[model samples]
Target: MLDLRVFENRELAQRILMAITREAEMIGREVRLMHVCGTHEDTVTRSGIRSLLPENIKIVSGPGCPVCITPVEDIVKMQEIMRKAREEGEEIILTTFGDMYKIPTPRGSFSDLKGEGYDIRIVYSIYDTYKLARENPDKLVVHFSPGFETTTAPAAGMLEAVAAEGMENFKIYSVHRLTPPAVEALVKQGTNFDGLIDPGHVSTIIGVKGWEYITTEYGVPQVIAGFEPVDFLMGVLLLLRMIRKGETRIENEYTRAVRYEGNLKAQELIGRFFEVRDAKWRALGVIPTSGLELREEWKELDIRNIYRVGVPKLPDLEKGCLCGAVLRGLALPTDCKLFGKECTPRHPVGPCMVSYEGTCSIFYKYGALF
Candidate 1:
């Protein structure tokens, strides 16, 4: 039988934490490291790593959760597509990952649309949408492609597959945002986090070199980290070392998956079909070249064109919603009055509480509200 003790290596964890603490103290400065991955935030909070760290060492959560950053307008636009198709007496199938179903918009969610007699299916992969398109050529199958670089690779591959097969029924409503531009926007806004623990999965596709501009221009150190406790601790250690030595560079702690240059074929596929454009994040307003749109060459495959629809402009939220501040790292979940009591995960008034990777969801799951 496998020993459980192997997984519960508390002594090693303590040593790593102590080493980071010691190194941070030697520098005579507070080490404020921002983790740019929601999974890392959840892991650190659940493991009580924040309590274990020195008082001077702080970890702030960045805009790493894709769902939290997705603008309300995109959700509104998706609902409009569904409503339009139903009025024309045509079958419109909306497919996306399960997490997106519960994400609320100014109108409602895919779940709400499904309740109103819309054919919205929760698909595990984009390939599933392609298969459905092949089987039901008569129906309009629109896949909601809302994600960052980590998911864009597979979504790009699916587009390629659809193109190769010449499937006209399948369409992708893309709200895919890139990572490097978002990070650059944060830096340009004069945000003052000392270092960044870059996203591991995103780094796997875009690589460590993707953050070169942040280091060269903003003089901030970045380390791509894995999801493990040791990996996070080591990332902190490396960032502290960089700050102490007065060096700003990009490092990859999760070297197993990421390299200096990422997957070339995946990048090529994304370049072939998508072009960068200004996008409005839910919290952060419009950031130039932060979003990906389907290229003009592939306009025929674009759902927005086929449906003759455009993304709508949504007004600000109702009172007592600080989702924008939270996503910008200006506030935490606990800072909001409606965090735990009024805005629990079960009945989320904001998008941050709806998705599993959201900061509010992380706090709710790990009992951080109290």
Candidate 2:
């Protein structure tokens, strides 16, 4: 059996830290590295990895959190559905991840709607939403699916199962998106990060090969890393080494779970039910081929088709919320004026402070040491 303790070994962490220092010193310039994973940020901040690293070496965050990237328009659409349901005296049950429940939209949050006697619920999985649909045949159950590749696979599997059964009461509002396009958009928009620490969880589904475009196209190297401190440090080391060597390629540090080709079965399952299209991200606007839509065959279960919901012409973010800059690697969570005082977990001013995977939330939970 593998010893889980090995990853957290203090002595090993020191050795990695020393190597990082040496690499950063050899690089002899300001090296800005960005990791597109909220868990990576948590590990970096919680482990005080930044405090240990050379001052010249900076680690920034990208648009990694699925909840952070989920467009406010999607929430508005759900709100419209709820309003129409109540007006028409229809029982419409809306289900989504717990993090999404507290996200503030122009029409307030799902929690607010629930308080007003709406059938909005916090579900752990698509399976839970399915169970709710099965139990309540009279109500229209809508699963507000929002995630990257990691969560999309399971949602696709559930969609397949639901379609096979021809479940009429069940519907899905898919805000599922692809990570690569968003990453590419950052590069195109000039975020100014040297290397990337690719998200380990997302890479497990999209595969190590999924990040090759970053190197081949933008000439930026990336390393796929796990959640552990050692894994994150090692990823930084590998990326720095690659940069020092003047090489651009995608490296995998989390090999135990991720593969070159990725989970083919999961990919196939997703392809059958969803198609790639331009998607509207919370901060990034619309990115081509970044969002997933249900295939024509599966359109019968798509909420967007059955229900017409108008998202108000509103700013993507709330007043004084710096989540957009934070997600784009242009600013840190601490840079936000509303980070600590006005925006705590209890009261979130933006989606970034709401999701566990959001950079702002991670930084709030684990104070930035650097």
Cα lDDT of model 1 by residue, 55-160, tens digit: 8988888788887788888877878877777777877888988878888777887889899888899988888988999999998899998889988899889899
The lDDT per prediction is 0.83, 0.89
| Top candidate (TM-score) | 2
TM-score of 1: 0.95
Candidate 1, residue 14: how far the Cα is off, in Å:
1.4
CA deviation > 4 Å runs, candidate 2: 368-370
Q: Please estimate how well model 2 matches the true structure, expressed as its whole-model Cα lDDT.
A: 0.89
- Residue 47's lDDT in candidate 2: 86
For residues 209-313, write the lDDT of model 2, one tens digit per residue: 888988898898889998899999999899999999998888899988999999999999999999999988997898889999999988889987877767766
RMSD to the true structure for each prediction, in A, is 2.4, 1.3
